[model samples]
Target: METVTISPKYQVVIPKSVRRQLRLVPGQKVQVIAFGDRIEFIPLKPARELRGMLRGLDTTFEREREDRA
Candidate 1:
């Protein structure tokens, strides 16, 4: 658990340790969400970087007789 103080401009600096762990670089955009009372920050990645991320998964499944074409 970490504590951070919000600056007068309503900005808070993410801690170095957390930043290093999350590989957060400067100028990276993050999606901020307000969940109930606490806020969350999710790092955004380019669609190109996410390509082929789910390769080789078990996709086979049993199909109903009427649904099969």
Candidate 2:
């Protein structure tokens, strides 16, 4: 297990090994979720890069439009 110490500013550095494993880069945004006593970090990509993944979903665009309509 890896351990990191939080600085006085309440900021903790994600270690090199962890950064490499997660492919995290400087200025990358992460979604922080608080689940009871534990916290989760989820990486977010630019919306444009996610277009293909959204297109691949089984739901059709018309179905989504009708639901929202």
Candidate 3:
């Protein structure tokens, strides 16, 4: 795991390797979350980019009769 130090301005610069791996671009927004003792950053992708992301997935699953609405 890579480690980063928070700057005096309360900002941390993401490493180039990490940024490239995540396909993070400048001006892209990320959602910050504080979970337990660690912070998490999730990239916010545009809705258009999500199109066909789940293509050809096995979505056929049986549901119980009572579970049907």
Candidate 4:
């Protein structure tokens, strides 16, 4: 396991290997989620990456609406 030190300003540097593995870049947003006793850091996707993820969801939602009606 890699070790990191938190700076006095509450900032910690993610190691180079970990950053490369996670595909993290400078100024990228990260989400810190609390899971039980540990925290998970998830990288936020850029808006372009989220554009078409809902393509099938729209049809599913319409089908559900029609079923309810």
Tell me the tens digit of each residue's lDDT in model 2 across 1-69.
688898999998888998999899999999999999987889998888777776656764455555765
Model 1 lDDT tens row, 1-69: 789999999999999999998889999999999999999999998899899998997899999999978
lDDT of 4 by residue, 1-69 (tens): 788887999888899999999889999999999999987889999899889887866443345555765
Every candidate's lDDT: 0.94, 0.85, 0.96, 0.86
Worst lDDT 10-window in candidate 1? 49-58
Model 4 per-residue lDDT at 59: 48
Can you give the TM-score per candidate against the true fold?
A: 0.79, 0.68, 0.79, 0.65
Residue 20, candidate 4: Cα error in Å is: 0.8
Question: Candidate 3: lDDT over CA atoms?
Answer: 0.96
**Candidate 3 lDDT tens digits, 1-69:** 788999999999998999999999999999999999999999999999999999999999999999988
Ranking by TM-score: 3, 1, 2, 4
The residue pairs that clash in candidate 1, if any, are none
Cα error, candidate 3, residue 46 (Å)? 1.1
Relative to the true structure, candidate 2 reaches a TM of: 0.68
Better of 1 and 4 by TM-score: 1
